[model samples]
Target: MVNFKGIGEIIKILNMNYSKKNYAIDVSGRGKATPPPLQHLLDPINKIVHSQRCATVTLPCILKAPLPKNYKVRWSKVEPAEYMEVVILITNGAHHKTYGPLGSRVRLRHSHRYDASLTISNVALEDEGRYRCQLINGLEDESLTLVLELDGVVFPYQTNYGRYKFNYFEAKQACQRQDSRLATYGQLYKAWTEGLDWCNAGWVMEGTVHYPIINSREPCGGRLLLPGVRSYGAKNKSKDRFDAFCFSSAVKGRVYFIRGHLNFKEAIQACQKDRATIAKVGQLYAAWKFSKLDHCDGGWLEDGSVRYPIITPRTGCGGLPDPGVRSFGFPSKLRKKYGVYCFSVK
Candidate 1:
């Protein structure tokens, strides 16, 4: 009986030792079950994060985050409903302005990551606040803030359209103010094709007529063309009737002008006396520019030709000699005659 009892005791001790060993193994398993080290788990998904807001009073918040090859960064505002007015989407980088409606959300694809930066354009005044960039990996997320302020003015290219009228002198002044001069022929051609005329006459620097003088050998001879005049002449045939000389910047080859109230022959003599001649259409076109044409009651052309006319020396008169009417147009033959004018440029 004693031997049997001792054997039973030994068996009981072995069972207890086995149970303790099992418990230790189970505990070790539970303790070791701790997730892989955070760094090792994050290695494949780790990313650098950054964000920014424009310094301008009206601009959108800009957010940036480093992402894996296929990972994407999502953006959202953490503000309340009333504060939602501050969110905007950027479109164009050149202008650096926000353009979309406020509170509008946009999704950026993973393909757009360049140096881990994403830009929003045309931010508004209310968009001048905090912003968050939410980096999404698996189910985890991280965010950053960008502050913005409004500071600079947005300038666009000139695009105003309307009919503007001004005299030659006034036009020049206007061009100077606008940091541009009268439109050149090429500009006029473009404007015309683009249908910008709107029935307004454009100004060509070539429209001003400077009276010239005849050479000394000519019948109506004068030394120093136009008599000691260093520049072309501005002659007023009558009160309030002033004629000036204009040139075309586009065509540096020649000059042109409109003649007012004169016969063809007298116009020729007048131009000869000044060492200038009547303007031709080609010359007119070469020197033409775009400008607002004014509608005036009445104006005269040399030789009474509403259309431009040619000027040449007076040669033959059928029967009359020394007639005061020395021009070759119907008006010149009439009892009432007007003087001829021409233009010239250096």
Candidate 2:
């Protein structure tokens, strides 16, 4: 029986009425008998268990990679197994925060083999950065650090229906359709600083409106002003409609251009026929930036834009002297005739 001396602390009482051979506990002043060793259930020392399979790390450990759905990263074990609880900590360049399933985006497995592990789902640009798991053992705190890197590209995105047609949620969904997500402010700024020039404003991850400007002409911001990213901060997320600025990690895949002049539907079908999906604008950008791929002919990217990337500046390519990604804006899906780019994951 437990004596209710106070509410904060629990006092266990053994049942004197029970036989010597039979182990029983009096659970509370109610006079009810329960199993033996009830004291261990509330024992602070018994709360945490050490992993038997893996050796504990002497120093902090790190695991870094781009993770897709259903992928898991194993965590390291902590020394001095005298802690009350284990906590997983995540830190970006800006701040440090704890991770839990209740309020945070990350979920802790609480399982340990060789070591402990943390698992995450629906990983976004905001989710990438640094992480560490801490053991809050009695009288001592220990931790191991990890760095997660996502290798992907960032670009602007808009719905096929039209420009400024998506709300914040819809914008994210549209990016997902293109194998991407609404770009974070940092990501959009990175793209802009890297010379991603677009005339149209788009919805970024923070529900704000922005656009990258480079060599700002009258149509953009202005040739007179120093080229930079323009912004419309903190608009109504639910009511406002806009395009999306998206970011995508590099996939383990190959991107190639399909042959023949085909309309949008036909272009998509050609890729499907070859067991590939039509490449997204960000994927195209990634291919160009990372692979140095150059094609003389402008082709259809996933966003319905006919564009081509030129790595080596030469004559006869779009009749442009500069080496860059040239765009043909969003064209009519039924009437536009152009080749399409396709991506296949290995």
Candidate 3:
């Protein structure tokens, strides 16, 4: 919900359910200005976020009239719906307080100038979500919405079924099985720009099959072909069989490689013994890309594949010149033995 005020201190009455279902509220006062409609204000907010790469996002929530000294700015987050019960009151400008699992520096200014804005510093992957910024006007409840996105790495995947075994839908399901989603074209291109190289063609989020060849060769594309992301365009969702390119977003928890080679089932038990769970493919990729996790041996990911991240490739470690998350495809879970990666929040 949004509140609109006309020029010269006009008051528009808003009647919405102002349920304080456990959230924090902050107050700000911005002096008189020719304010635009709530709808007009939202478009600019989206442009500001999407236009550039940002570590921190600044969002402004508008209020009618000179902000009341008692008027407040409120913030809350909800996800999975089942965890809705954990909504918390983070802060109220002056009387700052902490809430939720991941904590960042949230600041608010009630200056007598521009509209009230909230800033969260040192943003993390878990910070990506829908945040409600509401204005406290007694019965006339007004609010605005703020959305955050993550910046992370993407890796291509192949199920135990091997290359070209998946159609578009099966490719998507394969990524989900590995605790990942099908990579968007944008995500794949970003990975290409960040030095991701693979020879096998795979399915991405755009209902298309593609592959990146950093160094063209006879097996990859062609010996004379230049390096680039090759595309198979849009293929039939069910008929086409191909591998999958999966995307992993940054996560809040930590990932560790469990000592000793363990198969799929044993991997889960190993992590549980250490107060953790088997690390997903995404978690491992995030740890590799962001946390600089470098492992030489191919270990068991949550999807039961043997893989390793070689940030600095060398002999016997996948590629020699290229840095990537190398895969042994999806190996036999019960027959093959490999170390397992685990993840834990605490």
RMSD of each: 32.5, 16.4, 10.4
Write candidate 1's Cα lDDT for 25-68 as tens digits: 11111132122222101222313222212221221222343333
Q: On TM-score, who's better, 2 or 3?
A: 3
How do all models score by TM-score? Answer: 0.21, 0.59, 0.61
The Cα local distance difference test for each model comes to: 0.31, 0.59, 0.64
Tell me how far the alpha carbon of residue 254 in candidate 2 is from the true structure, in angstroms, after superposition.
0.8
Candidates by lDDT, descending order: 3, 2, 1
lDDT at 194 for candidate 1? 35
lDDT of 2 at 346: 71
Backbone clash numbers for all candidates listed: 39, 10, 2
The 10-residue segment with the lowest total lDDT in model 2: 50-59
lDDT of 3 by residue, 265-336 (tens): 887888999998888887888788777888888777777777787778798897567676777777777854
In terms of TM-score, which candidate is stronger, 1 or 2? 2
In the range 47-162, model 2's lDDT, one tens digit per residue, is: 22221101121212332222122323322221111111223443332234553431254444433322234555444443443343433233223333344445556677666566
Q: Count clashing pairs, candidate 3.
A: 2
Between candidates 1 and 3, the lDDT winner: 3
Candidate 1 error regions (>4 Å) = 1-66, 80-100, 103-116, 152-346
Q: Measured by C-alpha RMSD in angstroms, how accurate is candidate 3? A: 10.4
